[model samples]
Target: MSTNFTYFADMSRKGIFSGHIQAMVYDRSKPFNSLPLLPPTGIEEDVDILKKLVSSSRALASVDGKVQRLPNPSMLVNTISLQEAKASSEIENIFTTEDELYKAVSDTIQEGQASPSTKEVLRYRESLWEGYRRIQEKGTIDLDGIVAIFSKIKNTSGGIRPPHSLTVIRRGQSEFRAGEIIYTPPRGPGIVEHLMANLLDYLSDKVDPNTDPLLKMCISHYQFEAIHPFPDGNGRSGRILNLLYLVNKGLLNHPILYLSKYIIVHKDDYYHHLAGVTQAGKWKPWILYILDAVEQTAKLTNQLITNILEQMESTLEHGRETIKWYTKEINELLFSQPYLKPKLVGDRLKIASRTTLNKYFSELQAAGMLAQIKDGREVFYINRDLVKILEG
Candidate 1:
């Protein structure tokens, strides 16, 4: 590593430089073949970094405890994962509204009703759940598993970017320097494979056994983005890997943390810190950024969970008092997802008659516990409070 205070000071003022600069030989236009391997030296020794890690770890543990204590943890997983999917996709410029996404999940939207963006967002959610499942089963994700996740996210059978693929990350189209190259990921005959292998090893603790899991996650994320292993969906795949890594390490029992929300709020800082690591060897800022994301996201998620639990309890109490047919099962079903179709409700509650199910919905709506919304010939009963909480 080299120190160029004058040069980095300018970049730092522009939010591009952080800790220190790497070798000057690094070029943005050419392939980053010299990209360093995992477990960067002295990162674990920084007192400031260690302090952030401790606070982040504590906040993350709090979220894990809150999630486990829920009677229907899968409900939180379902809602939060979809939220992550939407936020992560939005980062890539994929746009979709929360209503459309929830409608798609509720199946109230007919075939071809979901826009391409919404479908893509749903695929992200699917990929996230699948990755979490694979982590639980295998206790670790290998290169093949990584490819599988990317494949599911992209809805293609394609694997890693071959040696010939010319993938270059660039600025957004709306930016002043639109289409300008920001960084060229590693490319060569075996460079990607070798780097990916090292990343997998590091993730499995085979390379950096003493490194903290959270710190290792931040390092692996940068390396994965730098490697740019897949031809597409690398960013989304890397985000999924973040949650899965936390779960695999037992820091989280379920992949429910909405880290993407934090990234969305700090989009500029996120990219700058990533660039900090790639352009310069500034691990401290990137590490601190991710630590802040984890800690803040954990607190936000914890608050979201608290709001949801409170809403559920209040809804249950009100429904019990207002509706004659109201039961705990109905409240649980309604809160399982923000949107619900009549048939889904009937099927879940084992109500065999359409007329009876209709009455239940009507009574619930009349009691102000559910709001009715129409989409074409279909009807959806929405828990508006739940939707508001989720949208937040």
Candidate 2:
């Protein structure tokens, strides 16, 4: 059925933002088919498309350890690379429900999300941990593990898998239609489940595990998203799948390259490219996008790591006089985890005394090499200057 789509506006009179529109679907039996309530004029520039390309390219280049001039001479290549990075990172960073959701995801993925939080937090934590475990033990992809992991996130226990009736709304102010699928995931009763098992086997064994890791990752990501196997948490599942896929393929030593940031920023384009392939028989854009994200994220992540190392080196060099071996050791440790406690310091550095660890931490803080977090209990030592550089 044909649907009319329009945009919305904010209080400030700014045009309806992309990804922020309300859509109503009229049944074919009714007089109207659909109407997309849209906002007014969006921000425009003489060089909007190019400007977007520029921003995306700059972001992409920045991720890959290169900070290009704001407006570059090589518009064509930059635009291409920007699209690539934008596609990949969008897939990498799936948005959570809120700040709590973000922390839950961050903690679950980076650390472990085990403390008291929402049901979503618990599920995300369990799912992420399960993915990590599968990577560690089998170095193989496991659909059942993924299903079970998401089952926990959905707060359903004693089920073979999540039910297909679950619904989700991806767009703001847009409700789901009866026939339209906001997020109707696949059912794993028998036929669908069997297909999934086979798909995983093919992904695991289609090629020699030791070869063309990046290409393997791309193929696996496409295959998993196509399968759309779970009733809930598919987006999160897909993201985790990408990282674990890389780890199993040995592309990344750890799940540190959270490409989600890139994706989250270019979320609209990301879904567009994915839908383009599904609806318009397009694949190159998606593939190139994935490749660009990988290359850019890897380079950007590597740069972050390098910057952290360099900052550590410089800090240690400058503070060598006042700081002890424990100080340097703690600095390196903090670089690895970004957040730590005095207990972790004592345990990691083999400092038998908490007082000694605290002493070292205090001296480092005084030296402006470390800072505490919002949490009162945890005083996280940070390389402020390096942190700023990475954040920028």
Candidate 3:
């Protein structure tokens, strides 16, 4: 049976309204503890599109398995993680070049000298790893844990915004009207607390499980965003939750899916779909939007894994045939950080001579495996193919 999800209105405190003396109110408080009536969990949604989505995600799972089988998964992991960080941050208008980001996080470089955009991206990646580790250790994402995730990303002590803060989601800044109030989130400490408690319940699977985990994730995500728990960092934190939720449900073995890349690509439609549910009680379109995101991203991810494996093998095979100093360890080391320096690889391989280091990398450059990059007085080798794959 189809059900209507109407937005509930909440009265605002006196003087809380936006400009022009209109009483400010929040009308998007659709709770998540209950009342998101999904279609029957099974055969009802088994349309051709759903079937294709299942096939696409299943194919992603298969490729994810193959990526793990590679001689070194760290190579792909580092590349994908940074790319995800870059793409996710870009959605927020924080921009940085790939070279700058890679150089910013480089162990040899000084962190203080990195551009603001680069530093933000590095923080996003670091926070993601922290969240992944937290989930792996605790096996649960509690309120405190979510706060900590935001803290790490924002580089501050992050917690839900209090009622006194007066955070309103607005568009365009105009002195006359304080911009248009797109939506005013729930206020009051007690109300926010209750909603968060319900969120924890949903995340823990303590609620009903009739809906598929994927669909539930979509609902949970909408709830979190609507809750708008934090004054800032809600978007990024919510995204981190997306990946963690997938992991919690065992949809992914590792946090390797670059789902943000897909979202950033469809940025406008992404927000529009979310807004549809908020304003018009449209659920099917939003759910299908996320399903397609996962499906398309999965297909893209699977192809990338294949490309990485093939490139790594090709590089290793070339080394085996031509280079006298070729070793699997050396090959993996290069892929591990597509930007290679002589001192770095030399330290790893115990080669004390500059000539030997240059020879090894130069041969690969000649083979089109690497391109010699000059950074001021120092020369570095860029794994051109890996860079392209990761950047794209």
The candidate that wins on TM-score is 1
lDDT of 2 by residue, 357-387 (tens): 7787787788776776653332344445644
Q: Which stretches of candidate 2 lie over 4 Å from their true place?
A: 1-130, 148-170, 174-185, 206-213, 325-328, 350-354, 373-383
lDDT of 3 by residue, 261-310 (tens): 88988988888887776665566677778778877887788888888778
lDDT of 1 by residue, 1-392 (tens): 13334533454475432223354456788987767766677788899999999999999999999998888899878988888999999989998988888888887345257888998999998898888888878988888788889999998999989988888988888997999999898886766886787788889988879899999998888888888999889999999999999889999999998999889889999999988887768888998999999999999999999999999899999998998778887788888888888888878878899999888888988889889988777777888999899887
The residue pairs in collision within model 1 are: none
Report the alpha-carbon TM-score of model 1 versus the true structure: 0.93
Please report, in order, the local distance difference test score of every candidate based on alpha carbons.
0.86, 0.48, 0.71
The TM-score measured for candidate 3 stands at 0.83
- Which residue pairs in candidate 3 have backbone atoms (N, alpha carbon, C) closer than 3 angstroms, thus clashing? 17-24
Candidate closer to the true structure by TM-score (higher is better), 1 or 3: 1
Best by lDDT: 1
Question: What are the per-model C-alpha RMSD values against the true structure?
Answer: 6.5, 13.7, 7.1
Worst 10 residues of 2 by lDDT: 31-40
Scanning candidate 1 in windows of ten residues, the lowest lDDT window is 15-24
